[model samples]
Target: MHYDVFNGDADGILALLQLRLAEPKETALITGVKRDISLVKQVDVGQATSVTVLDVSMEKNTGALSELLANDIPVFYVDHHRTGDIPESPLLTSLVNTSPDVCTSLLVNDYLKGKHHLWAIAAAYGDNLKKVAARHCVLNGVGSQLSTQLEALGTYVNYNGYGRTTDDLHYHPADLYQKLLAYEHPENLFSNKSSLFYDLESAYEQDMNMAQTAEVLFDNNICKVVCLDDAPWSRRVSGVFGNELANQSPDKAHGVLTRNLDHSYTVSVRAPLNNKQGADEVCIRFPTGGGRAGAAGINALPEEQIETFISVLQNYYD
Candidate 1:
């Protein structure tokens, strides 16, 4: 038996689709929303001959990953997340590529020789790699209209992963993927299915609501910081707030912090649209975070350091 594990976001799903299409196989898929990164621990390794992990990082789930590898199950990982000690065994075939220039979807597209360029474009949009996505679309001969539609679907599904819990999403990402699978092209998706557009629009509205209600913990000429309490809505809203705020204040950076159920905080930090190079510096203070010049995040931060976290933001402004 084979099990395919991936992140439940647009990039992860698209990457898996590219792989499955390349090598059609009977396999069980393991995934959940963006927050459910620790899903590997729950899988019964003994039952599978191989595991293909996409989007999710092996470093983050080292214990479970080690367990799977120890059971003699071959593991194939494809991601652009941070890396740790990757086991050196013939049983493991890993393609862990972590770089600021590309996303997991694009990586897989390159791995598969660009046969599924449209799906790769969608994945790039979902990850906010607009320039890269546009360049690829142009090269692939995708017209402007189709490109925009694909971008919208990618953005919508990416936005749906924000809320702190599943309830905040207008539609669970898995269901959204099912809807996307129904159409062969983005034109058919938007033209033939009013329901898909409506659902995406509804999700966008709720995402805006969360953004509007975000508590202003810090406000300055160059930056704004907001904190959200743990809730399905907040989780789903976290990344969306950063994306929306960046658009709203092109000259100012936007930072969103979400409290997890365990009293920790997961931060989504974006540099000013005009100066996206500072995002990496902003996340450097956190032990478990790093990213490119324009965007970064700390996957988890202890609650007790809330004060310190705020202080770090102040440093960015100063």
Candidate 2:
């Protein structure tokens, strides 16, 4: 059996889409809410012959990856996140780039020699690499109108990946991928009125409005922190809100903290857009935290330590 393990966000989903579209495959898909990065451990190596991992940090899955290699389950890993030390194993085919400007979809685009460049551009847009996606659009002679459409589609798709669980999402990432696989071109998806685009757009608008009015927990020259109440909307919109905040203030880091049912916080941290570093370092300081340099997250940050988190972020960015 072949297993397809990937992050649930647009970048991860589209990365796998490009590959499967290029070469059709029969595989069991493994994924979860966007923050679920330790997916490799879910794969049963005894029942798997090969695995393709995408858009997830290798650092978080090193142990499981090593076990997969030990069991001789060949693994193909591609991502744009912090990867500590890639293991030296013939069973592993790894392609990782921590460049702030590149995303997994773009990496897959290069791997596939740009056979699916349009989808790659959309994924880049969804991942908030707007400039990078625009360059690709211009290079391909894609007009501004179509570029804007792609950006919206990518953003909506990426937004659906947020949430503490699949229930909070309009479509499970696996189901979303299957629905998207039928369309060879992204334009077809936009033209289809029945596509999940409409649903995601509606939900995104409602959630984003709520997030916009969330209370500002902390604000300073170096960092700003916003807190949202414990609700489905908060879980759904926190990641995108963090991205929006970072974009709005390119020089200042932003943290979007959503209250969890247990009173802990689900934190989404974005380093200053102008200087996309230290986010991963700061996040990894917590137990349930890990991500790339530009954007990292902590799944369940203690409420009491919220102040400590702010101090660390302030100190690092200051």
Candidate 3:
């Protein structure tokens, strides 16, 4: 038996789809929404001859990954996360391509010899690598209008994964993947969801309006920080707010800290688009938190450190 594990977001699902479409095979799928990437540990090696892991961090899953390799089951890891020490086991084939400019789908496209280049652009768009997506679009004769649509679809689908729970999203990403896989072009997929997009755009507009009213806390001039305590709107709009703020003020680094049910807060960080340097250095201070220089997150922060965190952000600004 073979099993496929992937992040349940549009990028991960599209990467898996490209892989499957290039080479169809029977396999059990292991996936969950954006937050569930760490759940790859639950997969048992005893039940499969081979496993393909996509868009999940092997560094974070080092223990489970090492155990799987020790069991002599072949494992293939394809991802773009911050990596630690990777083992030399012959049973494991890891593709750790952590380029700030590209994404996992583009790496998979390279692996597949670019046989599905169009899909690769869609994945890149979904992952928010707009420049790369646009370059690929031009390379493949994808018109500007079509590229824009794919960009919107990709961004919206990725946004769907930011909900605090499945109930808050338009559809669970796995459910959305079913609809997505039914079409070849991302434009076609967007066509199927025109009504959904209209509704989502309106909701997004209202949400942004509310977010603009959030109190701003400047830890540093370069970094803009905001805190929302136990607000339902905060949980729903946290990620989107980060994106919107980053775009609206491209010169400043942005962070949004929202209280989770456990009283700790979740942190979303975004570096200015043009200069995404040094974001990772700040996040590595916490366990189970790391990402690209431009975008990163911390799963949880002790409530007590909230003030200290703000101070640190001020230091980053200086």
Candidate 4:
């Protein structure tokens, strides 16, 4: 059995899509909500002959990766996140790059020699590599109108990956992947008025409106913090909202904190878009927090520590 493990977000899903489209394969797909990065541990090595991991941080899955190698199950790992000391094992074929501008799908595209270049652009857009995606579109002679469509499609796919669990999402990542497989070109997915794109666009607009109304907890020249009350929409839109905030205020870091059912918070932190540094460093200081330097998150930040989080952000960016 071949197990395919990936992050549920657009970058991960599209990375796998490019590979499967290039070389059709049968594999048991393993994925969860976007925040669920420890997916490698779920693979039963005893029942797996080979595994392909995508977009998930190597640092988070190092133990499980080591175990898979120990069991002699060959693993192909690819990602664009913090990877601490990749293990030396013949069973492991790893392609890990932490460059802020590159995403896993782009890496896979390079590996596949751009056979699925359009899909790669979509993934780049989804991962918020706007300039990179634009360059690809321009080089391919994709007009601005088509570029907008691709960007919207990518953003919708990425937005669907947020949420506390699959139930909170518009479509489970697996189902979305299968639906997307029907269309070879992403523009085909948006051909109909009643398409998935329309559905996701509507939902995204609604959730983002609600998120925008979140109370500002703190705002300074260097940093801003906003708090959202516990709700399905809040949880679903937190990460995307943080991105929007960062883009809107490129010089200032932004933090979006969504209150969890347990009164703690799920925090999304974006470093200043101009600098794109220290977000992971600040987030890692808290328990259940880890991500790339440009953008990071804290899964369950205590309510009491919210002040400290704000302080850290201000100090770091100051």
Candidate that would win on lDDT: 2
The collision pairs in model 2 are none
lDDT of 1 by residue, 170-229 (tens): 667666655665545556667765667657757677756866877888888877888987
For model 1, state the Cα shift of residue 1 in Å. 1.9
Per-residue lDDT for 1-318 in model 2, tens only? 999999999999999999999989999999999998889999998899999999988988999999999999999999999898899999999888899899999999999999999999999999988889999999999998899988988898899999888999889999999999998999987787877787788889988988879899899889999999988888888888898998899999999999988999999999998998889889989998888888998999999999999998999999
Give the per-residue lDDT of model 4 (tens digit) for 19-98.
Answer: 99987899999998999999999999889999999999999999999999999999999999999879999989988888
Q: In order, what lDDT does every prediction score?
A: 0.76, 0.92, 0.74, 0.90
CA-RMSD of model 3: 2.4
Superior by TM-score: candidate 3 or candidate 4 = 4
Q: Which runs of model 2 end up more than 4 angstroms from their true locations?
A: none
Pairs with backbone N, CA or C atoms under 3 Å apart (clashes), candidate 4: none
Scored against the true structure, residue 262 in model 4 reaches a CA lDDT of: 90
Question: Model 3 over residues 111-180: C-alpha lDDT tens digits?
Answer: 9998877778877876767788999988889987888877766666666666566676666666666666
TM-score of 3: 0.89
Each model's TM-score? 0.84, 0.98, 0.89, 0.98
Better of 1 and 2 by lDDT: 2
**Which residue pairs in candidate 1 collide?**
162-235, 162-236, 162-237, 163-235, 163-236, 163-237, 164-234, 164-235, 164-236, 165-232
What would you estimate as the lDDT of candidate 1? 0.76
